[model samples]
Each structure stands twice: as C-alpha cells, then as structure tokens.
Target: MNKAITEGLLLMPPAFSNGLDQWSSQDGTVGSDTYDGAVNAAFVAADQDFGGCLELLKSETTQKLRAMVQTPLHPGCYLQIKARVKAISGNLPNVEIAGWAGGAGDVHVLDVVEAGPSVALTSYGEVVEVSAIVGTGARNGVDMPWGQDALYGHFGLNLTGANGGVVRIDDIQITDVTNVFLRDMMDWVDVRDYGAIGDGVTDNAAAFNAADAAANGRQVLVPEGVYALASNVTFESPVRFQGQVTAPKEVRLSLTKNFDFGSYVDAFGGDEVLALEKAIQALFNFTDHESLDLQGRRIELTRPIDVQDVVNNISTYAIRRVIRNGQFNVLADPAWDTDVVTSTASYSASTSTELTNVANIANIQPGSLVEGNGVGREVYVKSVNVGAQTLTLSQPLFGAASNQSYTFSRFKYALDFSGFSGLDKFVLDDIEFQCNGISSGILLAPEGLIFHVRDCFITKPKDRGITSHGRGCQGMLVDRCQFISNEQPMRAQDRTTIAMNVNANDTKMRDNRVMLFAAFGVWAGTGHLFSGNHWFHGDGETDGVRRAGVIFTTPNPKSTVVGNYIDNNFIEMTNEHDATPDWNNQYSFGGITITGNIFTVNDVAPWFSWIVVKPYGSGHYLHGFNLSGNVFRALNGNIERIERVDETYAGLDMSKSRNVVVQGNAFNSVDTPIFNPLMVRHTEAANATTWEIPTDGKLPFGGRARRVEGFVMDQQVLRGSNTAHYEFPYVSLQQGADQSEAHLKWSQACRGRVQITLRMDNAT
Candidate 1:
C-alpha cells in the first residue's frame, strides 16, 4: 500500500489568535523609516482570529521588521515555513524565513527568501511557502565561524526594506520534514544512546538491530561515524534512521558479506525433466539422481531412463518436488511445433499481398514476419482477417503462391531471479554504501512502495549500483545521489523471466551524478522521469566500454529527460568500438521529450551521434519526440550530433516517425562539423528545382544543387583571408523549413587561414 508521510507542525499556537506572547519582534529603522505593528484589523476577516492579526507597518523609509519564534529543531530535517502577508501600499516587502543554530561557539543561519516584488501581494494578500534544509552546509554566513557541534536552532521570519508600505504577517507555521515515515515519533532511540560504540573497528550491526527492534516505529539515530557490519543487517519492521544534521552525516556502513538471494524454479513434467537436468548440469555442474533430492525421496537410476520414468515414480509416491537455485532451460518442444497452418488455396500474382487459408487464422498476429516458400518472399504481417480466413502482409509478394508451408518462432529467455527481495517503505539517506567488488549494491525484489534513496553515495560495485524490479514497485525515487565506478549506475529490469517484459514504472531519477559507468547509466521503464542528472564515462581510457548515458529499455507511453543547467555533462560514445552515445526504443509508444541537455565530446574518436532510435519490432514508429534547446560541443570535430536509426540502420521514414521537432540546438566544433550522411543526404541530390548551374566556373545561382528539408542554417560568418570560395545559399527562409547546403571550396593556399561559422536554427 502507498503511504504519504505527513509533516509535523512545529509552530506553537500557530494562528496567532491570542497576542504575540510566543513570538519576539525586533524593529530597525534606517533613513527616516518607521516600523509599527500590533494585533490589528488590517488582515482579511476570514484569516484573522478574534477579529485581530499581527501587523507590521513601514512608512517611506528603509525599515526592517523581525519576528522570530525560538523552537527546538533537529538538524538535517527540511523545515517548511509559511505565512500570509499583504502589501497595503507602495513596494512589496521582502520576506525571509531563516533558521539559526548555536552551540559550541558557532552560530549558523540559513535563509529562504521570497523577495518583495516577486511575491504577489495585494489587498487580499497571498500565502507563500518557503522550504529550506537545516544543516551545517546550509549556513547563511560567508564562512565557518566556529567548530562544529550538535545543532539546536530556532526559525524566524524577517521582513526588510518595506519602503512606504504596511505588511501584515499572520497564520505563520513551521513544520519538521526530516523523517517522512514517523514525523510525530519524536522520541528517538539513538544507537549511541543504546550502548553502541561508533568506532570503525567495533561491529555495530547488533546494536543497530537491537535499537531498531526496541524503538518500535520511532526514529533510530546513527551519529556521524563509521559503523562496520561483519554480516548482513536486516530490518524486519518499519524504522527511521537519522544521521547528524551538520553535513551529509558521514555514517559509513561497511558490509563484509557475500551476496546470496533466493531463486525460483518451475515445475517440470514430461520431456521438460531432461531439459531441467541439462540446465542444472550447465549451471551448477550437477549430474545423476544420486546428487538430487526430489519430493523428499532418493530414487536410484540404474540406467539412462527417460523423463517419463521419473514422472511415474513421483506420481506413484504421491510426492511434490521443490528445487532451489536449480536452473531451468526451455527450448522449442517438438510437441508444440511451430508449423501450425499451411495455405489451403493458392492464386496467381496479384496486386495485394493477402493470402486465403482454410485453417483458423487467429494464430497469425500483426508484426509477425511470414515467409512463403512458393513465392520465395517474406513479408511482415499487417493484419489477420479471422472471419475471412485471410492474412495481409505489409508488402506484396514477389511471385504467385501455391500451397506453401509457414512457421513462426517465438523468442524465450531463461529464468534468472538471483537478487535480494522484500524491502518496503525504506529510506536510505545520508549514507555511503560501498560494494567492494560485489555484483549488486542493492536490489529490491518483486514489490515495494515509497522507497526513497536520497543524499547518498554509492560506489565501486561490480554490476548495478541500485536496481528495483517487479510489479507494484511504484513511487521509488532516487534523488541527489552520486554513483561512481559501477557497471550500470541504476537499472529497472523486467519483473518476470521474459526477455521483453516490463513491470517497473513511475520511478524517478533526479539530480544524480554518475562517473565512469561501464554500461548504461540508467535503464528505466515507463512513466519514469530522468532529469538534472550528469553522466561521465571513463576518465581518459578508451578501452571500449559500453557507455550509454541513459537508455529507456521498456516500452513506456510517455517520458521526459531534462539535463542539468550547466554544460558540465559529458555523454561519451558507447565505448570505442560502437561510438553511438545513447539508444531509445521506438516501441516505447510514449512520446519522449529531450531538452536542455548538453553533450560534450572531447576525445578524438569516431563518434556516431548523440542518440539512435531503434524500434522493437518491424514497422514500429517513434512518435511525438521534442528535442530542442540542447548544446553540442565537439572539441575533436568527429561527431554526428543527431542521427535517427530505424530498424537497426541510420535512416528514418518520416511518414512513420511523426510529429518530431528538433530546434534551437547549438553546435560548436574546432574543425568542420561532421554532419551525418542521413542529415545531409539532400546535399548530394543531382537535380535542382529552383536554381540553375552556372556555366562559367563560378558558383551556382543559389549555391548548392539540393535543398535540405526540415533543417535551416540561418547565418554563416566567415573569417580570415585568401579569397575563400564558399558555395551555399545566401538567403533566408522560415524558421523550421528546408535549408540549402553550404559547401566551402578553397585552394590549398587558404587551408588554415579561413574560419567558418554556421548556425543551425531549426529541424523537424
């Protein structure tokens, strides 16, 4: 079940129904400005209690009004401060909600500001909410003033520079948003509070386990230290573990256990018993019934017996068998043959590719490629008319078809469920989980909900860093994290054993940094948003690692991937062998939006392009893609920015791929930009529609012989000397229309003396 963790209200007598007994106010005057406030009737009647509200008035000067409420606060928790304010006249006042912490000779203050003019305040006033995390790094000062200690603080609202205006404050509130699981459970049982040493050498796993069991559902605090675990630590119930509030509470949980998880084995009968035996022998090197335990009975096999003998023996004994960690391989069974139907009637060569059959046509599905032996052709099935006993192909047959035999093959995969399972409503924050040479860092099995992993560092895993598989694994958010040196930073694989089955959905990956990810950085399912994340491949070694930034493997309906604000992200090629950077499946069915991303290609390798769209099945189209406002910087000038690959090739059928907009992209290259052949194919056209070739050895009337559709190069600024002869259209068109090619032709005397600047404005 899904759970919404509510915040705890921290304001005492929040409404200000009484007087300002619980609040302290300070007024400062500068440049003939006066501040005035009391329980007044300036606020709206509905918001005021007892027909009165706290009002602060300023008159024609720089006046400051500070109203603060001192309260005990926990560090590292997010505090949401809200209030209702009005600007009676003149400029709107600047509002600041700040947290002040003082202990061990240090005073730290963090502020969240809602500047005056931006806050919409009129006679009716408006409610504004400002959120800030309370921690040492969030301190407002310029530098660290004193030594660090346990944080204790108060929250306050400061209204400053209200020139010639009266701003009233009412209905103020502060909330504790640290532990979403149990916000009201303030009675925390710390591991150190319950006889636990946080030294690096001591085993604190038992102490943490004890404190978790005894604290019920309260918060369990693990202070800033290195807590080592000699074995795996398991939590049986819901618990909240909070760390120090100062920095990212440096609680390192060192685990030293070999990973092991349960695996599922299917029931075998008939000829399947031999398949299972072969699979077991291949996976675990096991042979013969002497080493096997079936149905709690030890059966001796004297000779090479058929699978029917084992099935009869188990049926006679009235026993059931359970296999653990046993592999199961399923090949094509001769009993379930692929040759289901044959053509009953035949006809001569016709205009259409429809064939009549006497057998049931319900088995024929769309997208299935069927081959006709008589016609010597293979066509993709478009539709099957079950009532008419006819099947239509996407293309016409080459020749006439007689009675031809047809067969269909379906792909299958082995069942591999070797991962952890059964974790729910757990939050892993403010901790560093290092998997030293292990395959998986954390793998959630079939179903879980509301799993939040934020503000953590995961590094050095052999395989995936974090993965959530299975159905009902909804609302899993991985935010503000760092993953370093892993095979796949994060992935969401299929829940079942099928090859193309997808179950993970509604997962969000935001504001994470991945460095040196060997394979795909993120492989997510449908309805997943990947935003504000940065990925970098290996430092400088070009040893051919399959480095894709983000890949959407599952068939999602609609998704969005937005990048970081700056230009620090480097989307390297998919290793040195295949230089394609990223891949998106067209079968996702969902419209994908890729915007505001920056691709940095610094290496001097043969880079294919930024992204390639590969469809799952034949005739599948990539629809409704909006790729705009991205920057491509190629320092080595060997990269094709964007190439559309349909059916495993670098070509796109514009009729099938509909509603694609590629605009507002900037490309910076040290040398001539390498445009993909698919993008500049029109430049090689033999005929010109609007312009004529020149007779005299000069340039053509409109420069090139072809016009490129859906791409516009608006302006070209050429520099240097030596009379460079550039042949291109010196004209302008609509923003997103076809563009003419700019061909630079100069003698060897002007080789390195000229520079060209071309601007790509629109693409469709």
Candidate 2:
C-alpha cells in the first residue's frame, strides 16, 4: 500500500451538493450553487462521481470556493484527494487541498498540493486524483509543524480561470494512506494449511508450531473450530495468532491435561533424601514440613504445611513424598484408606470457606488437598473432624457442590513455563485457555516485549490467570478478555515468587471482565492502565489477609506507582483483606489518577474501606493522589470513605503523605467520610495561665512528640439510610495542648438518618 492509502483521512465520495454545511464560498461571484439533480447531472459520466455534485456558476469577478475538513491530520501521513471536474466554457478550474496550522486568520499554510489531470475528459466530466505526503517543514513560506499544532485541511477550487465558467465538482475524497495499509495488510498463514484437524480430539501442537515457524513475523490464523492441544506451544518471534471467531469461546484450544510441570523438577542425584526434598520444594515451594502420625506409625512425608501451601494449594500432604528419581508419590494409610467418597451434601453460595459433610470425616486432616470430581472444584483442608465432618478450606469455593465424588491428593501446578528468554511480540488471540488446576494459565519469560493477548477466555487457574515477571518483560496488552475462577485474575507483581513476581512495565489491561476471583482482580505495576474493566465477586478469600479491587504495590523509595490510570470501571461485592483495603499500596511519586469508578459493597463488614493510604516503611509514603469523580454506594459497617494512617506512628505524628485531593465524590450509606486518628498521652499541667491557640494550628505535643498536619475533605455528598444513620462532623481529630490531661473521644453513632452536604477544612 502507498502512503496515501495508509495515512489519508478524507471520506470516500464526499458529496457536497446535498448540503453545503461544511462548505463556504470564498467569493460571492460563484452563485446558484444548488444541490439539485441538475447540478449533479453535469458530472454523471465521471468514474468517481455517484450523485449530487456541487454546481458553481462563476460571474465576471474571480470566483473561489473552499470547504473545511475538521479532522485533525497527523504528520507523516500521506493524503489522497479525488474529485470529478466538469468544465463548461473557458479553462477548467484547478483543485488543490491546503492544510492550515493554529487557526484561521493565522495565515500559516502547512501543506498545499494541486490535483493531477486524469485521462481524456468526456462531454460529461473527468475524474482526477491528487496525492501529497505531509511532512514537518516550511510550506508556502510558513513553518508547518504538521502534527505538533492544531491543524485542519481545506479543499479549495479556483473558478477564476474563465468568465461565466460553470464547474461541477463531485465525489471529493481524502484518505489516510499510511493507516489503511497498516490496518488492512493481510500477511498471515492459516494453521489448517499445516495439515491439522480441528476435531477437538487431534493434538494440534505440531500444526500450530509449524504455522508459527512458517509465519516468520506475520500472523498465524486459526479458523473457527475446536483445536485440541496436548502440550504447550512456543512462539519464538514477533507474530500474532488470529482466529476467525468473534469471541474466544467460539474457537477453543482445549487442553486435555494441565500444562507440563516436569521442567520445574530438579535433577535426580545419588543423595536420595536431599534430592527428594529439593524436588518437592521445587514443585510446591513449601515453606515448612514435618511428619504426622498415621494410625500409630509416623508417616514419612511432609506435614503441617505452611499457609501459603494450603491457600495456594502448592502441595498436599497426601502426596508430600518425593522419590529418589524426582517423582512425587501419594502414600496410602490404613487409617484413612476407604472407598472413594461421594457426597449428596449441598452448599450455598457464600464468602465463607467452611464446608459441612457431617459424615465419614475421620480420615481428613489439615493441609490435605481434596478435589470435587463432579463439581470440578478443589480445596485445601484447613480443619476436619469426625464429629461434624466439617472441612474448612484455605479459600472460599465460589460454587456449590452436590452429588460430587471427592478425591484426596496433593495439588501441584499443572502448567509451568518460566525462565525462558527471547520470546518477544507473541500474540495469543481468540482462544480459551483452561488451566485445569494449574497455578497459572500463561506465564511469560523474563525477557519478552509486545506480548498481546486479546479476545481470549481463561478459567480455573489455581493461582493466576495470566502473569509475567522481572523488568525485562514490557509492552504487554491484554484487551477484550475474560478471566473467571482464579485466585488472582491478572497479576504483575514486582520480583516476588513465580506466582507474585511481575515487574513488567508499560502493561495495559483494558475492556476485560473478571468474575469470581478469590483475590485481587488485578495486581499491576508502574505505567499500567486498568480502564473499562468490570470486576465482581472478587477478594472473596484473602487467606486471612487484606484484599483489594486493584492493588498497586511498588517497593519503597519509589514514591508513586508511576503513570498509572484507573478509570471507568465498575467493581461490586469485593470483600477486603484482613488488614489492607481496596486500592492498596498506591505510593507513587509520579502520582495516581483514580476517576470515574463506581464501587459498591453490598455485603457489610467491619474491615471494608474504600481506600487506605499508609506508609509501609520510613521512605514509603504517598507522594500525590487524586481521588475524584467516584461513586460509593451501599457501603456498610464502620468503613472509612478514605483513611490516612501511618502504621509507623502510634499517636499524632508526621505523615509523609502530600498533595492529596479528594473532590467530586458521592457517598451513599457510608459510615465516615474521612478518618484520621492519632493516639496521644497526657501529663500533669503547671500553674494555669491564659493560653492562646497556636497560629500555625499545630497541636502542641510533649510526651512522645511528633508533628502532624490536617487533610482537606471537600465537595462530598452523603446520603443516609434507615438501616444505618449518618452522623455529622464526620471529620474526627485529636489535639493535645500544654501537656494538660484531657481525653478526646471519636464516636461512631447515628442520631437519625439524614442527608448531609458537608465540607471539612484542615481536618486532622
């Protein structure tokens, strides 16, 4: 494609005579410019003309007509102009497109190009096409910063060539040639071309591999069919895998088994015991292990596992033993060995992790992993007893189980593809990736760039749906995707474990839907944009910790999560983690923008809060935060709309937070608008004397002295409910004066339900 086909922006066949709304005559001498059928008849024979041509009758004076195109043309884009011209008397008028920078009256021309003549003109008219490559340079003796300045183009016709000259111009068009070429270029290879069948039973791994290899740098196409994949496929170069289906659920890449995990196993050695331990550790990353009594004998396997193991199902005690050849083994004990257990028990949808069975529960123990064969669910045993047959899980099960076959075993990650390098610009589109009890669905290498995963469905990953690690992985975009039934749907943590370490930069997650996520909907990093996303029923299970709608956790010394924008999202029914609340760890020196979001907490709980800005360490403090244009609805319990507390301080102390603006927020059924608490001590006062308040408005502290500043809460509207009354003077503050003994009380009580429009200045 040429530059004009890619960069030109004019619409095709721009009919002008129908209505001259965007067109204006430069000279009144051009008259009788009606959009009637007579005007259009003059250019009927032109190839580019459809109908409704602009007919101009020129008088004795010089006649000129120009129409402005409001579209902003980009620099480096080629412009293609086409028009049908019919000249009736005297010389034919010339046509040209001119671009102007700044505004009208600036008289600064950025570009000017004349239309070229066509072949032979008939009695009707002739079609002419002109081209101009826009550049950033002087045009018409005026400096043209093509893209830098506000620019518009004009299509002008000079009818001064002949007196009483009648000219008919139709099918005027302008096109962006450069963009058209890049968007419509079809350089691809179909996977079916590589002798593969989409019968949903054939293993098409080789077919995809071959197509990707043949694709070189072009896209690999997968047609609308169910393609079965038995193994993982590697994309070694910059290539896209496009499918013919509209949604990812249409063209499925069904995996019969979990992704391979053998790569994570350590090599076997002569030291059998140590090798076995390393193999187990490599597979599960178990924090602690011990021996447990089975019947009367001490079982030779790991036991009493760490919370991480149970919460993430990293490993199960039933299959805790690793053999000498680096293979896992599940031991059988007579005390717990019984027929395969089946349950007619039913469970309701709840955020609780406890399950009741009431029978045949003597064998189950803590740290044991159980799988629901009928319901396709798994859980790590937190507690069990023969008396109640109650099994508490580390995380809540989103769905109910009934008439399900329960199998006991250790949970190991089915998929493991990590530590690979040189995989860049890989695209996975229009495919459904099933994890089948794996830790992650897709794990990128530490070194890769421009990885795009769009229009995809990923489900049932034990840990995360999709993730990447280290600073080397950047420029990843995940758009129009759905992530369901995962612990953490999308995570890009910084330098943690394989499950938590994702330090990728310039990553974006847009137009995605995440549901039934047991943890944070998205745990992202610096330069990340989470926009137009819907997250529901999230943070259901925190494993006794804090959860959030979206957590931006960067390390200390980095004052802010740089260049992050979270906007236009709807989040509902997300439970907070034990200590951390929603939108956690937002301490970026570069500032954060949280706007146009609607947060609803229907299930009331005491730990729920809209936001918490606290210092994790001495150097870790929020530099700038802008919380505006957000709506909080149906919030229950003693939840703070926005709280600022430094865990490092026990009393009124110096807070490192600065440049925080909270405005244009609406709260409904909220307990407190803002909560800033300080603990203070008192001492005996000396002889009484008249004391005036400090000019600086800082409360004088004597015991455990520390300085504190007030925060501003403005432009907030709070609506009261009958169930919970809203109280006034929502700003709670504590100030100590003269080392005198006095007690300050901050109460949370409602006298009556009433609507209040409130504002607080210098509220500490």
Largest TM-score belongs to which candidate? 1
Deviation from native of the Cα of residue 703 in model 2, angstroms? 20
* Model 1 per-residue lDDT tens digits across residues 323-436: 332222222233222233434434334534566763546766443435554332123344567898777543444333455556532111122121212334545555454443
Least accurate 10 contiguous residues by lDDT in model 1: 258-267
Q: Which digits, one per residue and each the tens of the lDDT, describe model 2 over residues 158-217?
A: 444445556666655656543432234557655554534555676666667766676667
Prediction 1 TM-score vs. true: 0.34
Error of 1 at 243 (Å): 26
Steric clash pairs (candidate 1) = 60-164, 557-590
The lDDT, on a scale of 0 to 1, for candidate 1 is 0.40
Model 2 Cα shift for residue 397 (angstroms) = 30
Against the hidden true structure, what lDDT does model 2 obtain?
Answer: 0.40
Q: TM-score of every model?
A: 0.34, 0.33
